[model samples]
Target chain A: MTLEILAFALAALLMLGGAAVVALTKDLMRLVVGLGAFLLGVAGMFLYYGHAFLATAQVFVYVGGVLVLVVFAVMVVHRANGGRPLVTSQHDIGAAAVAFGVSGMLVMSLRESVGGWLPESGTSGSSIAQELLGGHLVAFELLGVLLLVALVAVLLIVGPGERR
Target chain B: MTLLWGFLWGVAAVATIAGGAILGVWWERKVSARIQMRYGPQQIGPFGSLQMIADVPKLLFKEDIVPALADKAIFKYAPLFVFGPVAVSMVVIPFTAGWAPLNTSVGVLFFLAVPSIEVIAILLSAWASHNTLSTLGGLRATAQMISYEVPRSLAVLAIVLLAGSLRPLDVVAAWRWWWMPLTFVAFVIYFVASIAEMNRGPFDIPEAESELVAGYFADYSGMRWASFMMAEYGAMIAASLFGAALFFGGGWPFGGALGVITLIVKAILIMTAIMWVKWTFPRLRQDQLMSFCWKALTPLALVQLVVVGVVLVWL
Candidate 1:
């Protein structure tokens, strides 16, 4: 029991520390590294919550996909040295304020709404696959279609002049 | 008790990686020498077997220099990022019955996913060095890994379809004679993708020495550089072991201690094959590598997956 508590506390600390690093870092690449660390820490917490599938999914999606995408985007516009500051500028202060305000509101609202609610035990991979293919097939197909449309839209917007 | 189990397995995995990397270095030199019709490592232990033993101290004692304009924090720590995930992935590789260090439910997925984390480390080293050549190498690596990962996962997905489980042990145990014809295609794809993923042989654009001047870790020195080599060899060994586990009947041919020995021998054979290819083939052009992944491998893997899925459903 004590071991479990210590593990949880350490995971929480890692997540918070990574978050702090991401928020405070001044280099673009360093910010991406912090984001990767933050994602990994969150994935560890998901494992602690007894959702090994969710934890692995979190790693696959965030660490593998989104992190790579974010890094590629940064690399595209990345300056060689310390030319670009990663910190929020004065002009972006309003955006930052709004972000914090919205997140705080979300936390408060969720706390009030689900005060006594407990999450169900994690679902098995097979069950989730069945749910996606059988019970929620329509929604799954819709999501795929939406992604396809988004891909086409991006290509149309960013493709060579001939297609446009 | 579980703690002891985990610790013991961890120690064993570390020792395997350390010993494997040292031996792999010497073996690769010998293989390359034999290909070139020259004696290699003849002066070291016996047939230059102790060359790696000599090289380790040389690298360890050399000056660890940091670039004047480098990002000190990332430069100092990036090698850990490269080596750590590879080491962690070793835990999921089931060498024998009931012997995998950490056998999670999603074993194969978790095993494959863990090693992708090394991409960020390579990127950090390239960017932190503030060298254009290293940056180019890093970008090439990131591109190659991302491109090849799709077909790689799809090939494994095909195997998972036939096996109907993500557990490494299950995958190996599910192998049957009839499943061979289809999985043969997948096995080839997996082997090729694993080679590319480890950044070796024909796919080794990131570290193409003549062009990129040692690629992403060009600026690294001493033990730091050695760490990168260790990580590379470690990943290679892990991938070979995984390929053995997934498709080659794993440790089932012989039971007990012999089973373990069989699995290790299979992995070593695969590693030797990789080394053979590495020395024999010229590196692909960057554009050619990308096209091969996207145009050739991805489509073929997807088609193979569809066939496996269809067969599994109807037959």
Candidate 2:
């Protein structure tokens, strides 16, 4: 029980710290890295909750796919050069107030709903297959089509152009 | 006790990779040397097996350079990101009958997914290096790795489909004599895709020595640079081990202590074949490599999946 709690706390800290980095940092690259950290923390949360499949999927998909693209964009598009941070945030009173209010609401809501929510350990991999292919089959296949469309669009955009 | 055992096994896994990497490098040099008509590394050990012992220290103790423009933290730490996943992957390979060191039910996914993390590591190192050649190398490597992953996963999909479980133990548990000739195409696809994934010759456009000048690790020096080599060899070993279990009957013909030996011997044969192919084949051009992965390998992998499905259904 203690170990699980400690693990949960560490994962929460990672998510919070990563969020803080994304919120506070000026460097675009670091912001993407912060996002990666936040995603990994979410994976950690899934891991400690006995959903190893979900945790692995989280790492495999988000961290592996989206994080790479975002990082690549931050590097190439911004030309983030020689340690001078890109993607600077404008300091504003309104943004800070909104952030604080949002976090406060989250805390209050979580505190209220924290009881009787945790699942017992050890879900099988078949459950994931059933959930994705059985119950969510339409959504899953649609996602495939969506990604295929995006791929074709990108290829058409990049393909057989007059040399840039 | 389980946690302690996990810790110890993790340590053992890393140690195995490190030790295997030493022999791997030496053997690669010797093999390449023989292919090129020369004696290699004869001074260190009987067959120059210990040559890496002398070489690793030289690399490690040499001045570790961080280019002036490099991102200090990311540049310094990228090797760990690169090396760590490859090491963790070794845990799931079934070296004994009906068992692996870490026998998670998601063993197969663990094998595939965890190594994808190295893409981030490679990119980070590339971005951090801040050198144009290194950046170009990094971009090529990232593209190549990501592209090759499609076919690799698809190739492995056939094995998982046939085994009916993702666990390495289950995969090996269900391995039969006929599956060898049956899954040969999948094995070849897996083999070719894996070689590409590891950035080896014929597919090694990333670090094409004549073009990119050591590729993404161009600015890395000494131990830092060696870490990338270690990662490469570690990945090769892990991939070879897993391929042995998936395609070849790992730990077969006997199921006890001898099974482990059989598995290792099979893995070593695969490793040797990999080296032979690396030494024998010429490197591909960047466009050629990309085209081959998309147009050739991925489709071939898909076809193999269908064929395997048919075979499994009927037979």
Top lDDT: which candidate number?
Answer: 2
lDDT (C-alpha, whole model) for all candidates: 0.83, 0.85
Q: What would the per-residue lDDT of candidate 1 be over residues B1-315, giving only the tens digit for each residue?
A: 666777787788778888999999988888888988998889867887877888889999999999988888999999988988888899888777656667778998898788888888888888888877888888899999878888889888988888888887777667775776877788788888888988888888999999989999999999899889988899889998888877776786675688788988999899988988888898999899988999999999989998998898897
Q: Give model 2's docking category.
A: medium
DockQ, structure candidate 2: 0.51
User: Which stretches in model 2 have alpha-carbon errors above 4 Å?
Assistant: A80-85, A91-122, A149-164
Q: Provide the lowest-lDDT 10-residue window in model 2 chain A.
A: A114-123
Candidate 2 residue-wise lDDT, B228-315, digit = tens? 9989999889999899988987887789889988888999999999999999998888888888889998999999899989988897
Of the candidates shown, which would achieve the greatest DockQ relative to the real structure?
1
Error of 2 at B250 (Å): 1.2
How well does chain B match by TM-score in each candidate? 0.95, 0.97
TM-score of each: 0.94, 0.92
Candidate number achieving the greatest TM-score relative to the actual structure: 1
> How far off is residue B110 in model 1, in Å?
0.7
